[model samples]
Target chain A: MVDDGGLDVVAPIGGAVRDLLRAAPGASVDLGAIDPRSTPGLPDEQLTGAERKGWARRQVELVGRDLARQQEMLFAGAKVDPDAGRRVLLVLQAMDCGGKDGTIKRVVGAMNPLGVHIRAFGPPTAEELRHHFLWRIRRALPPPGQLGVFNRSHYEDVLVPRVQERAPEHVWRPRYAEIDDFERELTAAGVVVVKVFLHISKVEQARRLLARLDDPTRHWKYHPSDVDARARWDDYQAAYADLLGRCGTDVAPWHVVPADRKWYRDWAVAHLLRETFDTLDLGYPPADFDIGRERERLLGTAGPLKVNRS
Target chain B: MVDDGGLDVVAPIGGAVRDLLRAAPGASVDLGAIDPRSTPGLPDEQLTGAERKGWARRQVELVGRDLARQQEMLFAGAKVDPDAGRRVLLVLQAMDCGGKDGTIKRVVGAMNPLGVHIRAFGPPTAEELRHHFLWRIRRALPPPGQLGVFNRSHYEDVLVPRVQERAPEHVWRPRYAEIDDFERELTAAGVVVVKVFLHISKVEQARRLLARLDDPTRHWKYHPSDVDARARWDDYQAAYADLLGRCGTDVAPWHVVPADRKWYRDWAVAHLLRETFDTLDLGYPPADFDIGRERERLLGTAGPLKVNRS
Candidate 1:
């Protein structure tokens, strides 16, 4: 029922949703100020859990279908106009167990894999460490006509080093400028950058970790370092706040999505993606060849038509 | 010095060199038929080890310079003629302790990192396993104008599965044809596929592994699985032979580079790359803007320009 208007009305609504979720640039972030459990994008009305779930699911499906259609046009446009140089890169940054993977699955997984490229950054390999932090990230960048998603991205270079004291202040402090320059260049090169920071409460993370441990199927996902990371939760939050304030430029602003509620987080991300695609205003390229003549020629071919009946 | 003629003479010589090093497609590759220790591309005259090393080094330097220049032209061509869709993808496959890394360093490392993209495949991640083997490989492909190097590649999907019995015959056997189709599509899409198999002797691999074990600093490179892999050397060789014979199409052929001698392997790879670039027949793109006028304008403007001495 929620899919009636589909992405027509949803696009503008999604813009409003993004404005509500966006973490203002240069503003000092107080994790306490944002309620992670709140679903600001959803209708402000009383509803049962099942109803809310159904509503979110329907919204996601509608948004996902619209997003898929936009992506197809984007890809088609790229193929026809190779020099047009249009692309999208969605960068997702979150704390340990903060739903980066979930966001990728719920938001990006809905699109065609052919048009979507996902690069999940873990600890740098020996070879990756040999180059600048941005080197590997640059290599993983999606070319024109593709939607590139960075599960954990170049933002980690700033956050991890600052939070873990891995690098000296002089070394890591300069990175904010470096990142700004990198994103600027990316935008100039026709990459539209959309950065989202999935904001999850510390309590939610602990609960997720405990759930992982409780379920045998999910045990492989649990890491001891996650607990260690949890110990420095406040430090990580501070680092994230600083990152949000510094790296959030006009070209690539950071959106702090409330992620404690999985359904809301999924819905919010889908909405954001739909809004981003709408701004691109992409359309399928005109047929390069005579389709009517080709169809007649195909029909005139001397061959027995084989039809599959299953 | 071997750099006397530089790239001008070396470019043509490199073509001759490739012919000498190329493994004849459809030939039953007896690993014994090829001498891994031989430097086929170098001079036949006897020389001291130091002299030989110097000669090889100079040759690599010349070829590397030429390759870099060609890559610059290739990148420029892409910028000017986006639809030209010209690109090169070098797939390097080798046994354990083979000179894949060394070859990449000596050959590709000499070029501009911006123009050279390297994707070193390790064991597939959980996400990678969810899709087709070529899924990740396809994503890492070079866009027009760039040279992409796959340290290990989709060939592994065939070799590893066959050697270790990781998959049923029904599963892995069809991959040869699958690979053929994949490569044909790549070639059609303007990607020049250069597949190189670094042919190393079992003795050479053991020696390299032992050397790794002997060095305290190199312990990270050693693995118990290396020994396990070495134990199945004959099986891997058979797999390699089959792959070479089957997938070596007119569009994408396989070159078996004798890789027991690190110096020879490096020089040969550099030569192969130089030849590949030469075949592209690339030239620097013409300046689109009025450079002469811009130069005059700069000279006419602003008095007493400050120059930094740092």
Candidate 2:
């Protein structure tokens, strides 16, 4: 079992899930070898398809409650210590139709929206392009007591440019070090970086894309160019493998979530977050002012005001 | 019952909740007439206090689910037409310990964080004081297809300045017209503004503050200075009454929620959101692309990718 960062509470699923899902530092990922349907930390059971999905949904809900409490503690801690520098940045990177939005809805959505900062980084705008790639990212970092989610993050810089040939090898290769250095600085400043790569097979992508087309309501999500990305499946996988291998660091590691089953994918992401928060050993901050004095002063206040009747 | 706006689905609550809670446009508000313990939209039941709270909690959860779906429709509609200019901005204003944070965590927290933009307005910084009072607020308006919440809002300018004598009446007085014109512009631009005043009794506020002081874990929330604000409750109430009377308009109305009961406060705010979204007649936007052609292209893509086993 992986160590529970420093959480006093029992983890929903032991460190086993996070440990199993964590992409080893400096190890190459082979998309084919990881079964998208495999329930990594869940026990093998004789359950029907519907039952499995229901079970997974329930587990995610439970994890969400725990996450909500932990998040409150994180926010409270930051409030208590403005200089705490304790914050979480969760980076979600996925291919087209890989369920990044779904993961966010089910997992991050569970936290109080007040303390969560979500930024979906699409293609760089003209203004964004004028600055360094990390400029927009740096501006969006969560403050002392917040959970920050990047639906698509800086890793896109490496994956997209490399596969689409939008940038040269010399241009894209050094981004790994640039990213590492940036993450190192964030870690030093008390940011816990959790990077996740949603691994969906080419077959699953086709199914999801087809489902979107079949449902008129979902058509807004589908684009003709999604096929173009799928057409370069092999190239994109190679690019991802390289980035996952090179960028996975001791400070901020990558977790590859098999994305074939939507239910399993949602639960796994929430599990990863629960474990991450656990490691923070979060607790509520002590009151800075004199509690006894405050209580006396508070009680001394007058009762409900006598207002003029309407 | 109020008009259902254009909603195709049944509202978790009829218009009674919003209608009853609404602060009539141009009508002066008397804090004394409004009973903080009254459950405005609920049935006069034969249930115990615990049962009432339990019922409110469950009802809030149900309303939240509906709000989630409606919010998705709002998001989808926005995506289908970025120019739709359709968004809901919920502005929350309250006294100290008035349950604004609790409302956000329990009510706004029900929706996905992806499409919700939240800003908590605090005392102005040196830089913020340099600009027009509304400048910071204008910058935080929700983009199309999103839900935006203001924990404390532009109304603060009218309330704090007038009550605390931070600015002379000449400066703070005309802000009513400025705020009305600003909100008018927002309404013209397709923003549906839902303003709420979390009305807590002074006794309840004192009780809450004492509870915070009593709990070591809650000490971070309590401040010795909170009593300072409590001391000037009457001034703040008069300030709130003035703003509520003037700012409650047709385009953006104010809802005065009795927040003595935390559970009921959560349900009330959530129900307000549900009714507001329903009135907008939110729905998913149709696919912008050629669905039929995309389906053919997606299906023609090769099956599961053939990758070398690790």
Candidate 3:
């Protein structure tokens, strides 16, 4: 077990801890070795299942408040800072029924909707497919002072095509390098990229799928092809492992979150988000106007009301 | 003055009153005949300056709240309705210092930022000029459930090019028809277009320009070319007149707001916005999930938590 200080820690995830979470660049990733049930950085694992859920719930609430505050500061800073081009892009990648929607609602849903934008990528439309893969993604990037969340990002281009044998190795292999360069350019342009891979065991996914089947209201979300995708689980895992190894860079590292427990998954993602914001060291920008004069003017208790007439 | 049925009124701006405010399609617009000081629907206008200001302020506050509520409904309706393709595009066209920014801050700013989007168009970049003039405009259009405010929109294509002779008459003349078709298409696609022409006297503009020059803080907003634009005021007015006459269709009419008084302008715009939302007849969509069962599951007081194993 990795020593992660404690669950209540509220500092930037840096150095060894960040490195441990990241799939090392250019190194082989063993998906089987990393247990989906493991909750890294969580203390006292001896606690009962119910106790662990309660603890994670408390952590999520605390982290949610912190994340909201930091987001407000980021927005306030952009108002007055001339060089306030900094923004965040949180890319979520996962297998079918791996809880991407749940993660979005519990994690990013905590931030002010005004400052957060969520873009879910489904199959490309005819117009979208006409453009290069990156074109649509570039257009959907968050403007300054906003957090952009991509439910399934450009990574899907490589994943789906490779697994389904739609493209030969020659076509999709170079895309790993392309993705790294794209992420590097984004970081250079002041967009911090946080990519999360929600790791769920095949058994856990089947459980979630069955739950969806049990709930009549969630029937709209069910797809027949999900079973076919499940049949190719090993192929998908191989594609993911290759991606995590090859595309993971020092600038835009990937965090593999153990997502078997919904509460723990929410807590971990929220904690990482708060840590990212804290690392940004954001503050409110300086006031541009004469605050005293403007205050008096608005209150109508100052000098002559300045009105221009011919 | 037209009776607005008090400040609390929430009906569509209709009949002869709306006709009085609109620049009729295909009819020559007499810019001189339309008084800049006229406040159409405001009651008891014959009062002291302070009293009129107070009354307008109260009306703006009330109308602003109503507009906010309507915007909320529009956003809510989108959540449950699969075919909720409703959106709004407020296209603001005016001379420099005609109060587009102020109107945006006071009117749309009162609505939830999540539902409202503002795009201020400056001179086109090289990339933008490469495409058709409408390309960038189309991309920036608000998606469903959004209220998009375009400060100085595609109308600039007709006005600037014609007055400066940047393009020959043949080039800009065809654009009027293009604009009419574009707006008609938007209306067909469920985008309610509210076009406003802020009418300010040249003398009033000069006064405002001088004020910008006098204030050190507002120096960045000032431009010497603004004076040059003012010198060609009659040419701009002619171009604007042509636009109002030619492009004002029954589907997308133009409101010629007399904007010499800032408070009255805000009130009128806010009132019109509230009326637009009311005409839309938006309501919250029905819940799509089983609220009671989901509540029980979340509370952890119901059926056994389902889990699957391979």
Best by lDDT: 2
DockQ of each: 0.01, 0.52, 0.06
How close to the true structure is residue B14 of candidate 1, measured as C-alpha lDDT?
Answer: 31
lDDT of 3 at B107: 79
Q: Give the TM-score of candidate 2.
A: 0.91
TM-scores of the models, in the order given = 0.52, 0.91, 0.59
| Residue-wise C-alpha lDDT for candidate 1, range A1-310, written one tens digit per residue | 3443344434333337778788888846776799888777676354565577666767787787888778878877876676878999999999888898777766675665556766778788899989999999999899798888888999899878888888899988898999999999999999999999999877677667656655543544555567667777888889889889888899998899988888788888888888888788877665554445433333343134333111
In terms of TM-score, which candidate is stronger, 1 or 3?
3
**Top DockQ hit:** 2
2 or 3, greater by DockQ:
2
Number of the candidate with higher TM-score, 1 or 2: 2
Score chain B of candidate 2 by TM-score.
Answer: 0.92
Superposed Cα deviation of residue A68, candidate 1 (Å): 1.3
Q: Can you rank all candidates by lDDT, best first?
A: 2, 1, 3
Worst 10 residues of 1 chain B by lDDT: B301-310
Q: Global lDDT of each model? A: 0.76, 0.83, 0.76
